[model samples]
Target: MRGDAETTRATGSPPALRRGACPTLAAPMQTGDGLLARLRPASGFFTAAAFLDLLDAAEAFGSGRLDITARGNLQIRGLRAESVAPLSAAVARAGIVPCEGIAVEVPPLAGLDPSEWADPRPLARKLAERIADSGLDLAPKLAVIVDGGGRLHLDGVAADIKLVAGAADPRPVWHLLVAGRPTGVSGSVDAMIEAAMSVVADIAAYGSAARARDLPAEPLPPGSSSLALREAAMSPVGRFDLGASVVLGVAPAFGQMAAHIVRPLILAAVAEGVSAVRLAPGRAILLVGPAGWNTSVLVSLAASLGFVVHAGDPALRIDACAGQAGCASGRIDTHAVASHLIAHAPALMDGSLDLHVSGCAKGCARPRVADLTLVAMSCDGRPGLSIVLGGRAGDSPVATKRLEDGPSAITALGQRVAETVEKGESAAACLQRLGPARIAAAFSAARFNGIDHAGL
Candidate 1:
C-alpha cells in the first residue's frame, strides 16, 4: 500500500480508483489498457490447481498481464469494466478468497521456514481480527508487519506498525517499530499486540490520511531494548532448504509475468511435485516441493523459461515496468533497457544499489528513489530515455537518449562506470563522487563521440 500511489498516477484510473488508491478488486483502478486489480490470497500459499484457476481468471478477464509486486501481491492488468465482477466471482469460485480489512503482512514463508524464531501467522491473524472488530476507522492503507525472525525477514518492506522478534526468552520478545523505525519498545507477545492496537487507535483518531510518520514519538515502555534492524542474509531468488523439504524461489524477469508464461511454469511445478506456489516478498515465487522430489530438472527448466533461479542473479537488482510493449503510457521499452543492463552492466550490478526503470514519470515499479533511475520520456515528438542519478522517476534527467538507443546508452553508462570505479568502491559511491554532471556526461558520451551538433 505504501507503493500503490504511483500506480494510480499513471493515468486516469476507474471511477472507484481515486488518486493514490490501491487497486483492490472491489475498486479496480483504471490504467492505459483497462482496469487493474491487486489481489492477495487469504490462504497465503496456493495449491497448484488453485493457482491454475487464478491464472485462468487473470487471462480470461484481464489482458493476460500479471505482476508479482515488490511486496509480493499479485496485480492483474487490462481488466475491462464489465469483467471486474466476473473476475472476482471466478476467484471466489476457485476458493481463492482475497484477504480483506487492514493489511497485516508477514513474511511469505512464515510457517514453513523452520529457521524462523516462531511462526507469526497466529499473532498476525489475531492482530488483523482485533483491528477489524475494533470499529476503528483506520486509514485504508494502514499495514501491520509481524516479523518473526527468519531467513527471510521483512527487511525492506514498509508498514504503519512493525513488530520484529528480538530475544526469544521462553516466549519471543517483540521490538515494536513504527514506520520502519524502531520505537525503543520491546515487550512480551501480548503486550506488543496491545501496544500495536493502541498505536492503531491513536492513528485512527487522526482520520484516514494519517501515516505512521505523521505522529510524534511515543513514550517508551519500561525496559525497552534498543530497537534493532535485521536484514535477510540471502536473496529471496534461490533455493531454501526447509529440512523436511525444499522451496525453490524463482522470479519472473522484472517482476512482471505474462499469464501465458506463468501457466507453463505452474504446470511445470505440478509436474515436479510442487504442492503449493507461494508469493514471496521481493518479487519472488516460492515453489514448495514435496519431500524427496527431484527438483534439479525443474530448476533448470525454470531458468530456461525466463525465471531467475540463482540468488546472485543481477536481474534481481533491476525493477522495470511494462513499458511501450505492455503499457499505453510508455515512451520506451523499459524491459529491453533493463535486460541489457543485467547482461551488460557488471559495474552497475555489484549489489551496490538498485536500478529502477520507469516507463513514464510515474514510477510505479518502485515507490522510493533508487541509486540510479532510467526514465522513458518524450521531448516534443521525439521519444527519449532520461538518466536520473540518485532520484525518483519524476526527477529531471541528467541526460537523454533516443528511445531506440536506450539499451546502448545504458551499456555505455556501465562501461563508463567500470572504467573509472576505484578499487573496492561501489558503483553508487563512484557515481556520488563523480557527481551528476560527470555521470550525465558519461551517459551521453557515446552519442556525441563524432556527431556534429553545429551541422543540425
Candidate 2:
C-alpha cells in the first residue's frame, strides 16, 4: 500500500483502522498505500529548519510522497506498521506535534493580517486546549473554525462551531455560531470560549454521537446583538502584500509534493529571507519574507522545483487523487488522464471550470461539487471513467466510457469538449445542451478516433 513503508514489504499489509477514526502520526490508518500518518503542525506554521526536518523524516521513514490535505494538514504516505512508532518519535524529535482533540482551524494569516478584525491564533489555541482538557467525549473529526474576519477566510470550509469576529461597534466582540448558525455573541474572547464550552458540555451530557448541530435551539446570550454574517474572500495563492512585506503563496500540483522538492523549496525560501512558512487553506504554502527579497527569483525557483507559483496556472484547476500508482482502490491513472485533459483542453483551467479526476468514488481529492468529475472505474475488467457533471465524485455518474488504446483517445475527447466551449458555450451550458446520453455517445465515439477528432 502507499503509506505503509516497509510494513508492506515485510508483512504484506498493515492492520486496518477502526471505523470513523482519522489517521494521526501516533496512530496511523492502514490504506492501499500501507500506513498513512497525518501530522497537524502546531500553530499551523513551520520554520524553514523544521519544515526541512519533516521532509527528511518523511523520506526516511515513509514513502517519499508528502501531501498537504485540503484542511491544511500534512500527510506522509507509504509506511509500515513498524515504521509508525519510529516516524512518530522522529516527528516529536523534530518538534512537530499534532493538534489533539477536536480540530480547531484558524486563518493561515491569522495574526499577521493587518486588515483582520482580531488575531484568532490565541483564541484558537485556548479553545483547543480547553476542549482537550474538558474531558468531553468529542468526535474525532468534529472541528471548529475561528474566523478573525480577515482577507484569508475560513468561511468556505465547514466546521462544527464557528467563531467569527464581530464588526467593530466601538467595542471588540465575537459572534459565536454553532455549525455556522448564529447562537450568541460575546464581548470578550473568554466569554466566547465559555459559550462554546457550554455547548460542548451539552453535547457531552447528551451522548458522544451528538454534534453541535444536534443540540436543541437555545436563546442568545443576554445583551448579545445580531449582526449580518458575511464570508470573507480567500486569495491565498500568488503574491500579496502584507504591510511593507510581501508574502508569496505556493502550491504543489494536486497538493502532492514529492520529498525531493520539499527541502529545496524551503531552503530557497529561507535564502530569500523568509521568516515564517504557513500552510493555508486550498493547500497553499505561504512564505513570509521581506519586501526587498526578489519574489520573481523565488517564484522561478519554486516553479523549477515543481511548485505552482501562479494562481492562474492550469494545474490549479485539476484535482486528482493518487490513482493506480499509489492507491489500491484506484482503477485508473488519475494524474495521467488529468494531464492529458489539461494538455488538450487548456481552457478547462481558465478559472471558470473545476475538474476533479478521482481515483475512485471515494473522491479523496475533492469531496465537493465540481463542474466536471471523472471517477475511475472498471468496465468489463478494463479501466474506464465515469463522468459526473454538475456534482461530486460520489454522485451518480452522468455518463460512462471505457478508455481507448492510448492517450490520444482521451485527448480527442477533451479537445471535443474544449471545442464546444470555444464556440461560446459555457461548460454548464454545453452539458445542458448535450445531456448525459449524447455526452456519453460523443466520448464513446471519440475513443475510436484520434486526437484530431472533434465535435462532441
* Superposed Cα deviation of residue 76, candidate 1 (Å): 1.0
- Of the candidates shown, which would achieve the greatest TM-score relative to the real structure? 1
Q: 1-456, model 1: which lDDT tens digit per residue?
A: 323323334332334765455778877877766788998887777888888998898999999889999989999999987787778778889888788768788888888888777788888888888888898866777878998878888867888899887665687788788977778877877888899998998888777778787888767766768745556446788778887878888999888888888888889888878888889888999998877766788888888889998888888999898887778887767877787787767889998888999889989898788989999777447877788877899998899876666666777888988999999999889888888898888777656334322201
CA-lDDT, candidates in order = 0.81, 0.75
- Pairs that collide in candidate 1 are 13-30, 14-30
lDDT of 2: 0.75
Error of 2 at 70 (Å): 1.1
Candidate 2 runs further than 4 Å off: 1-16, 184-186, 215-232, 390-392, 405-426, 429-434, 450-456
Task: Quote the lDDT for 245 in model 1.
Answer: 72
RMSD (Å) per prediction: 4.9, 4.7
- Model 1: weakest 10-residue lDDT segment is 447-456
Model 2, span 134-217: residue lDDT tens: 888777777788888777878778887888887776755887778767775656899889988887787777677667778777
Flag regions of model 1 displaced more than 4 Å: 1-15, 219-223, 227-233, 448-456
Cα error of candidate 1 at position 83, Å:
0.5
